[model samples]
Target chain A: MSAMAARSPFRTDGTWLLVGPAVIFLMLFFIYPFGYGFWLSFNPAEGAWSANYQKFFSDEHLWRTLIVTFQLSLPVTILNVGLALPIAFQLRRKTRYQRWVTTLLVIPITLGTVLIAEGMLTYFGPRGWLSQFLQLLHIYDGPIRLTHNFTGVVLSLVISGFPFAFLLTLSYVTGIDPTLARAAATLGAGPWDQFRHIYLPLLAPGLAITFCLAFVQAFSVFPSAVLVGAPSGPTRVISLAAYEAAFEQYDYSMASAVAMIMGFAQLIVVVAVLGLRRGLYRGPVGGGKG
Target chain B: MSAPSERRHWFYSVWSGLLLGLMAFFILNIGLMVAAVVTNSFGRRWLGTWLPEGYTTQWYAAAWKEFQLGDVLWVTAEVVLVVVALSIIIGVPAAYALARRQFRGKQLVMLLFILPLIIPPITYGIPMATVMYQAHLGGTLSGVILSNLVPALPFVILVMTPFIEQIDPTLESAARVFGANTLRIFWHVLIPLLMPGILAASLLVLVRTIAMFELTFLTAGPDSQTLVVALYYAVFAAGVRAPQSVDAMAMVYMAATLVWLLIALRFVNPTQLVSRVKEQPAH
Candidate 1:
């Protein structure tokens, strides 16, 4: 025990040897590329001052995708967070099914957006299962409009986002001791009352954080939008705009500009959400600080 | 918390029922969609019907032939294996240094790891692709591997840090007192102790790398495309392939990921991930 003070306060030698490889690799590939992208956005090939940014903002079509992207992302964020809260609340008990239930709910997260899009096209397509079931029940005469539009994109986002939201929400919900709720109950706090006064305040910070995360995820959506939604129509989000600008239009600067816009939009909303969290009644941080 | 003596409002029961219904709806939705894909892949003809008319194995065979899936699967394996192996070699030691050491700039380094994770890959993928293209490395397999390594290595470090932190340092010190050098101690003492953590971390990296699309989509050449990228082309590219074949290809991608997912789940609970564990689940 006395020798503990004799050892170097930090680590034995070879600490750099351990951490150096990751630092070098990420600095070159991840950090450098990011800085390069930012630099490239500002320094365009044969352009005037901030031409790409100006061009992106000036073009009505390119900038509008930001609005369109938000429209889709906001609702999906609300639905995912809103739905996740109650479900996570309900599942906070130490029931035997908790492990399996949590595992099953998060299955879609592993499935990825592309696979979900594939499933949606089949289950929601004109000749897909949902349409056939509805038709057989005489719900409508014509085929249902599912994919190739806003509806399919939102649905896919929820399918992917809800699980993640639930996981976060559950961790927050479980972090609070059940005894607190019981204490509130003995004091005549009903479920709604307990939730509003106790759970909501504590969960608010986590919820705000969760919404920001889910919103960013939906905001950056590209695969599902292209795979299941009409790219030329209502579902033309910013990522797609960026992809086209880079890959299709062969305009790297414009693409980087759009990409920067996407990152900025996400950052603004995240900061706002976090700002709201700051003003709220902060509850105890629990679970894994995951 | 359920109280038998308490009387509940009618609305409470209905609310509880609705919540249950929502969970059921999601479960059924996921199951039905997966079932639809699986069945459609095997169905001989799936027109406007609740179930496919009949089933066969032809589509799997057809998808394999039409998509050049043999090559695609080979590429997928190559990319996933290289990323996982390299991530471990680099990340585990970093995790060790982090778990055992306290030093200046440690918090900053941790935040650096978190940044790649919190930010969407597309925000950075485009720029990376631009750099690769300019350097004539964009379409190469090495480019794809390096780009994917950005997130994978950070993920490895973050996940392994906690795992390493849990093991006692005294054991390593005891080994050191016995005259074991760094290499011998790491091989004989540290490796066995860290084996489970290593397995979980590796499997997670494998699953993640296989399903990762954004970076791979950006950097992969035609020959280096993984199955997910190939599936995207099969759907959106200049082709009018059979629906069954596409479904089969999607199924293959799904299976490839799901198997690794299942194995990873066995080693690590997904719930225990993304956040550190404060308490284990109560039975």
Candidate 2:
């Protein structure tokens, strides 16, 4: 800390002033609420500290929702990252087509969840296009059930999350020094070898960060779940459950407890990610342009 | 070698073709979705076809009349503007300190600011709403605005830090040498250099705020509902046969966001902004 003081002209007072606003803002809105929420988790209404947690664990529906949340998130993360890698690699060609591909990829970020669900209802619903197409081909006797189930929710999550993962990985891939790859080629290395030794190592940190980001995005999913996800099936994510508790039942204390548990789970996961990759923060992948 | 070069050319063409095909598929999907909403808004009926049967603007009229769509739009705009402005105001100075100065627990502070981003909104929304309720701020516009600050503040800080760090500190020192005080130096030298970053941050914040549904939905009551929240209620609540109205409202929301995105892309490079935080290597 003192080392930083020597380089900058700002005195201690001035630096504190500069950083104070952001800290206070985060503390008031983020940390305090988080702390209060955690406290509530321990002290449920009309019970001991562990009582609420015990109830949560005992409830089959709560456990089911948690499992569903994980089921939806894990598959979406894996699928999104898996699918995005090839598109990202191909886009590194830096051709005109690559530019168009990138632009098109950003289109989904603007579409809100409500619109996405509405579109799914019309396009993939029982009487929607897919069902009609299948029926016309004599592949099915009745309408195909795509909505109101796990299939619809997973599809929606994949569609919304794929672009985000793709964009993140694409940027990382392009940032790699092509010179390194060329040098590997000149050294009698093949494409796979070049990728394994040079590209993979550089991409490791980016991949980890992108996975965490994509996972969190999928985990916090609500709109798509409620809109397309069947409440009875394995699609009632923890977020949806928490929302119902807080608003529908007006059980603020219980809702806070649920939220706190989710937050803590996320924090632990992030800590694990950071711990697994020690040298991720070493250098900027893409050097800042002056 | 010549054969390999030819092979590479063939590979490139095939790969490019596939990539473009996927991109076009994605674009077409979004286009179809928008077209459906727009067609539905226009009172067009489509039973079992890709396109609609007929077209009219009566749904939009009905949606407007029934939902007080204009007021919802106003609330969204007002909240987004206030959130963006407040985030920039607080975030810029803090970003400068983080980038330029060394502080104890700096890493911890950075992590703390970024925590909101990692934790899903649902994780925070519940507790935050409870705290608001206790404070009697729940269901108020101010509560919604404050909850938004949780995410928006970190975003502004993360985006602006690199931009501020890029400005050579000597320039500010030079200004000070010319008898300009700290305040003056910041006002004239730093502000001008950071303007583009500020604009880019504002645009990002604006888009985020507009699309924000979960937090607002949880905290806002009927009077404070945003357009997205209103649309959510319209669809899920029982005895509400207003799918057409929902489609119409969604189209309006989509149009507003699309316009903002176009404007953002025109002024700020989306790639640059998205990658700003990742571009900063942790020390």
Candidate 3:
């Protein structure tokens, strides 16, 4: 295969040129904007180069957005990954129902967060079906205050984030050779033992990556944060702050600062997860020790 | 396989049952939420009821007129199609290279492509929009397209790489042996083999671009808003518009996504929905 690939005129000749456009495009669009934003964050309007950073750190109101965002993202990420891990493990083997379940889950994912927020507003509202159903069943009497609060944002995140977490987790879970589990079983391992001794070690690295991916998605909770969250109160996430800074205040420098801070916060979590993943098994994933 | 003893069987059944119950509850909640939106959109008065007081299509009409659905849909179609076409045009060849060639700094190049996928858009979008504004492209259709391509382009590369890797390079060599040049081998041989992948990437990008909110939201002006962004405005805009009308607009947005989603699902495995991009290594 390697020889064929090398002999093929397509690969040996100016195949490198084929990569040029994408590299140039990403450099122009993705990298340039990132560097530009970093630089712009320092050059604020009406003060020193550190003005935006100084203002952000000094203001309890501004920096508090970080904690609020973490509060929302952390629990949501943990919950999505936590619930998805076992379910994906159980469904790792092919089943007739897996397709239907995945298809159903894809509905919320494709529908996107904006529609979910809209649905949550009406469905979780005081007069919505959930409240009505709860009342009818005498489960609770008062209006369920799920919308326009911290809980609302969390619920919206799970609704959208869980399917994503599940799909990714399922892909990782299924990628493991099933014969590994069968081999473990033959060694008199129970389900829990198989999971703990066999699957978990192999899965540790993938789960860490999954956690980071899900964390990044949860961290940037914008549309749902605004539509379902109280944009001014407890649910005032950092992205919302950045949006306000850019569009409402027309301070691109302040917005850039907030965005940079957001990126920095997310990077901390990703790096930590990846660092931990390095200490895991990291052996052959296809069912061999060597 | 041997039959499990009663105790082990019992334990397994109970555990599976509990997980199934949880999944069922989640699916039910989602179903109800969507039903609530659809019901309210056609409802006369839905206050505290299992169903609406009466059904009518007036809200859809009202939403269409009030939200200017025609223009927003046109913009969304234009943006999504162009992004899909441009990303594929710019991405497939790169994927082919990454698949077939081993080179210096290839790992760095792979990392560059993956960065845009794992990083949250809003974090980068703010600065990207700032750059776009300075370039005099922000608030224009071109700005929206460029911002979205930041993610869509890389996604195309990541997805197509694996698909391209799977095709036997011997075929390309055979085409080369026949004196077909690189471009012809790609055009006549590789493309026909890659149709499934291209279709999958295009349709998934189509659905995603329509649903993509942050980049579009950050750079879009009133004229450039896509359907999802427009739906956000309808919900977020300070106004006295009826809830039903907004729900109606939400339904319109939902219908657009659902149609493409169902079609995309036929071509795309649900497990591949996220494109398995992170784990692929440059060989």
Candidate 4:
């Protein structure tokens, strides 16, 4: 598409003109507001530049959101990517069930977090079908308490995140040429060895990417945390804390600061995982990696 | 040697079966959860029970009036259509530029397009809302539509770029060589080829903005509320909330989203976006 010799009706300046509108739009709407938020975080309503920062750091309840967010995000990311790996590996090859499973998994992405939370409130709640069925079997003495706690929030994240993780990892895994694995087997490598030496190394970068994405998605836990999880307790993740600060408390300064903190936390993990990709299989995957 | 290999084969089979079983359970649980919400919206008495005692459509009526969903749906339609129209108008040219022309700062531009997608909206939504308030757009239809355009435009660009790239450049050149002008080529030559991509991108924009709870929630006035945001208020707002009414509203949201998604999926693969981002050069 970008070959030097290929001619277009427009000049190079015309090409630049084509790209201008989008960049200008984002600069106005996305970048400017984001910069404004970061700047606003430093100046609070009643104090110096660091007032909101100090307020947040001093208030243990307020600052703990960073930790709570990560606590749930890390596990959810691991579980989603971990579970998605083998399933994607198995379903990478075309099968009768593959398309159906993929579509079923993607049901949540379209369904949205708010709707999933709504569903979980009914099916996973105490005395709901899951609990009642378990009770009928005498598997437990009490109703299955799935909501209003850490379990509920984690379930919500996985329900939404797993499909995402699977879709991304399936693309990554299947992107690799299967002939590499077959070649390894022909050379006396078994499934275990083949996966360890070939698939793991090749899949590392994609896994890192998938993990970061899922983590970011999980870290921004809001509607589900408030709806299904204990928003005042176990699932008071960072986004909820920010929402409370801005809308509930009407402290835009403090809310801006918390939002910056949330972005910073996500950035740290994203940078770390992105760095990990350097040590993975760096050669072009299919051409030379096998 | 043969014995060890045979045992390993046995273990692999068992593990494969376990993995398959886990996927089946995951699918079944989500299916039942969806069924629960759908059924409960109409259930007469589902409290403390595995199944509803009876069902009725009265909740749907109650939900429609109680939530004032008719107006919300209208507002949602307005916001979605404007956002889609704006995103396409802004994004298609950019996609063409990125696909066809080499330039400096292109990588920077690419990264900028993705940042909104990667960084959660809540981080930016609050300040954007504050700006909207300062500018007196916060509680209006324009504000919600503007806030939504931030993500929706870039999304259109990202989806459309690959589509633009896949088109044979020679076709454009052929149209040009045939003396067709820019607008003439775009309308007569490029648009027909680009129609599927444009349709997919715009449909996704519609789906996304409707499901976009955070940005719209932050900026919407009472008169400007979208369905997902309205559903959120129904459950979480301070009052004695009816669980069934909330469920019913959620079903409405679900129906709207599902219909658009089913249509969009007909044109694009779910993995399409992920693969496009992966293929895009970051710098």
Candidate 5:
């Protein structure tokens, strides 16, 4: 390929010419923006100082918002992974039902967060069918108030995020050789024993990676928060707080601070999850090394 | 012994049933969302019912006439086309080099490509907007196209790398040995074989660029507003002059995206598109 490109009438330097411009383009657009964000986080305005950082830490609402962000993220991550595992296993069987289910599940990924929130409003919201049915049954008298609260926000996050986790887990599960499970079964292992001994251990790494990926995705929740309702009580995630600070309050300094904190928190969580996975691998290998 | 085998069979059946049940639940959840979107688009303001009381094509009509949906659709198509074309022009060769050639800073180059995927858009948008504004690119179609290159470039490279790697080097060597020269080899040999990957990458880039909201929202001005940005403004800033209008606009947006996705789907392999780019040594 290199030799062919060198001899081409389009010029031998085609590769460099084609690749260099895009690389430089990304450097200017992607790299510079990231560096600028980091610099803004520290500089806080005209001078190089930690005032934004200090203020972010000192402000009570910042901490509360951070906690709320975690509150929304942690549970959604757990639920998405928990739900994805069984679906992934069944998908490995490759039944006709699995194909239809996989296609149906992927619809949300294509649907933007705004659209998903809108759908939730019409279907799961107070005035929507779910609430109406509950009321008709006398389970509740008033609107269910699913939107504008922790439950609504988390549910939105979970619904939107579950597909991604499930797809990733499904791919990982399918990648594992089925022979291992069959071997375990033939060795007089019960179904539960075969799963616990052969399957879960192999799946642990993929699950850990999926957990972090899902957490990052859920952590960056934005349009859903705004469209569903402002993250006031339990829904006010860090991204919402950052956007509000920057756009609504016109406090770029504070906004940058919140964004920095959010990024840092996500990095920590990802690193910790990855670290735990590494720790798992470094442990004494049981009878099943593969 | 027979009793124990029967009991085990029953347990497995129940377990499989539960798995199938969960799968059904997931399918129903998504099915309901799609149904709600379609129904709400045409449904009369049906309160206190599982299904709409009445349906009409009025929303579609209003979307086309009152909303200026055609203009917004054109803008979205134009942006996606330019972004995808520019990305392919820049990405395919770079991916070929990264995959087929050994060079310095290869790892760093690959890392730089993947950077956009790592950082959240919110982190990049503010500074990107600020930079683009200073560069006189902000609020223009050019600005949106340029900012979009960050994600599009990485995606193309990631998708194209593996495709390029899978191309056997022997064919290129044979072309060279026959004195066909390099450009001829690339044009006749490499490009044709890599057509599927390129098409897939182009389609993926187009789909992504059209659906993008945050970067366009931050960088695009009123004059250059894409469909998604327009929909956002209509929903949030412009009070639904008619609530049904919002539904109409959303239906248009969804239909437009689905069409683009379907068109793009024909050119790309779904499995290969999702994986990231990794460098392999050339023999």
Candidate 6:
């Protein structure tokens, strides 16, 4: 080390003091509770260290909630990301009306899950406007069962999740330099070729990140799964399992166990998506922010 | 990328038209859903009818009286304000430090900030609530504020780091060279430059904390319930009250969020919310 460096207190400088309060706060609140929860999950009220895991895996009813959650979240994530890509791609170019459209789409996100559930129950209910309109128009006279089921929960997820997916995807789509496509066009390449050879590779990493985020948001479905879904039936997601264990049955250890498992499940999907992203083209995300 | 009209193919126009129609249909459904809630909140006895038999504002009055909305709104305001202020106080400095320094274990600190964001709240909310109860802070306003800070603080740091990095570091150095202490430099030189970012972060946090559900829900008590949590309870505890009243309550919650959301949008782009995911270290 140089004599100047040896004498200077780089690590203990006053600048580092700026970060001290936040680090201490996170340790006391965030990391400490996470570690404490992990330890607590193992030491159940009465049983062996592995009892919660044993019970969770062995009981078909308990473990099945994990599968149910995956069923809901996976599809919702795919749907949100898939639908968002096309729309966002189309809207990638700067326009006078773009902000207004984005703002309109953001309403569902600001409205939160509970409001969406409440709105779904009334608007998509059997006696709701949708049913009456369909019946009057003779589009389909059969019964319309949207609420109190898996489908209702999916609808709520889409309403809330789509805007998020759309915005993120829009940012990615807009980041690509449009001139690349135009350059390809000048070389006699068609739109499909330009997109396939250029845009797709650049978009892959962003899409993977988008998918992971959307999946994580959808995976922890609590309020919608209850308000608009059959809580005891198809929509008994993992978060619901944890909520019931903690709040309903008053078992904090079991709840922590369930919550840990929930985090583990989300981590698996995120890891898989990010791992996939590793192989994709990684250039500067924005093409000069044009 | 807009092609000249004469050069645009007919097929392309048709496809664009179809896409426009689809967008309209989706927005229409969302509009109808919100309209349905607003209509139901004011409607009288009507079932299986295109319109309600009549409309009245009694439900709003009933919801206000029965749900103790006054208390809920007050609690929501307190929680949102305190969380915003605390997050800013703690987050801005950390953001500045991270932006300006190259310390050991920087990746670990970045990871610490990112985890709370990518990990869904329910996963940590349960454990945090458990610890809060153990500490005798659960079911209180403080617990709600603390739990919310977990996400809000990281958010402020992530958003502000980029902002801080954009500011020329020489400004700080110049202030120091003039014999100004750290506090003096921050107060006079940095704060003015950081005011825009601070405003944007606080506004976004305000909107988020008002709408945050899982954290506040897991930690709050009857008296500490925010509007969103209270709205959840109003719907969750079924058969004890009128649906219209609950809808009315939902409307009130929507209005609160909508007002802040509009104000937030004026200051911050909506896309900036999740675009920070791109800022994660590539390693």
The lDDT per prediction is 0.84, 0.76, 0.88, 0.84, 0.73, 0.87
Calculate each model's fnat, 2 decimals.
0.59, 0.57, 0.76, 0.63, 0.37, 0.68
lDDT of 4 at A54: 91
> What clash count goes with each model?
3, 1, 0, 0, 7, 0
Q: Which tens-of-lDDT digit does each residue in B1-283 have in candidate 6?
A: 5433225568767866786677778889999999999999999976889888999999999999999999999999999999999999989989987888766556788888888888888999999999999999999999999999999999999988988887898998998899998789779998999898899889888988999999999999989999999999998875699989999999999999999888877777778655563332211
Give residue B130's error in model 2 in angstroms: 0.6
Model 3 agreement with the true structure over B176-223: per-residue lDDT tens digits: 999998899999999999998899889888998999999999999999
Give DockQ for candidates 1 onward, in order: 0.56, 0.50, 0.60, 0.50, 0.36, 0.58
Query: Between which residue pairs do clashes occur in model 3?
Result: none
**CA-based DockQ, model 2:** 0.50
Model 5: per-residue Cα lDDT over B1-283, one tens digit each: 1113322657777987897787677667666766676787788776677877888878778767766887777877788888888888888888888887655456788888876866667667776776777789988989988888888888888888888888899998899889876568778998999887788778777767777777887788777778777777666543444556666787777777777676764554232233341322112
What candidate 4 gets wrong by more than 4 Å, as runs, is A1-13, A279-290, B1-8, B273-283
TM-score of each: 0.94, 0.91, 0.95, 0.93, 0.89, 0.94
Mark the regions of model 3 whose C-alpha exceeds 4 Å error after superposition: A1-12, A280-290, B1-9, B277-283
Predicted candidate 2 versus true structure: per-residue lDDT over B1-283, tens digit per residue: 2113222446657766786677667667766666666766675677777666777788888889888998998888888999999999988889988888787667888998788866767788888888888888899999888888889899889888988888899998899889997678779999998888888788888887887788898789777888778877766652476667777877888887777776776655445434453443221
Candidate 5, DockQ score (0 to 1): 0.36
Candidate 2 global lDDT = 0.76
Q: Judge the docking of candidate 1 as incorrect, acceptable, medium or high.
A: medium
Q: Model 1: residues >4 Å from true position, as ranges?
A: A1-12, A282-290, B1-7, B272-283
Which candidate has the top score in lDDT? 3
Q: What local lDDT does model 1 show for residue B247?
A: 92
Query: Over the stretch A1-290, how does candidate 5's per-residue lDDT look in tens digits?
Result: 34453464335445565568867888889878667767777877654488887877778777777888787889889999998887687567656665566565655766667667767766776667678778889999888988766777777887788887887787677667676777666667766676677768888877887898888888887777766766565666777777777768766666767777888899999999989888877544333333
Q: Encode model 2's per-residue lDDT on A110-150: one tens digit a residue.
A: 56676678777767777666677788889995988877788
What is the per-residue lDDT of model 3 for residues A260-280, given as tens digits with 9 covering 90 to 100?
999999999999888877755
How closely does chain A match the true chain A in each prediction, as TM-score?
0.90, 0.88, 0.93, 0.92, 0.87, 0.92
lDDT of 4 by residue, B134-247 (tens): 889998999999999998988999888888888899998998899987678778977888898899889888888889998999999999999999988887762466788888
Q: Give candidate 5's error at residue A110 in angstroms.
A: 1.0
- What lDDT score is found at residue B176 in candidate 4? 87
- DockQ-based CAPRI category assigned to the predicted complex of candidate 3: medium
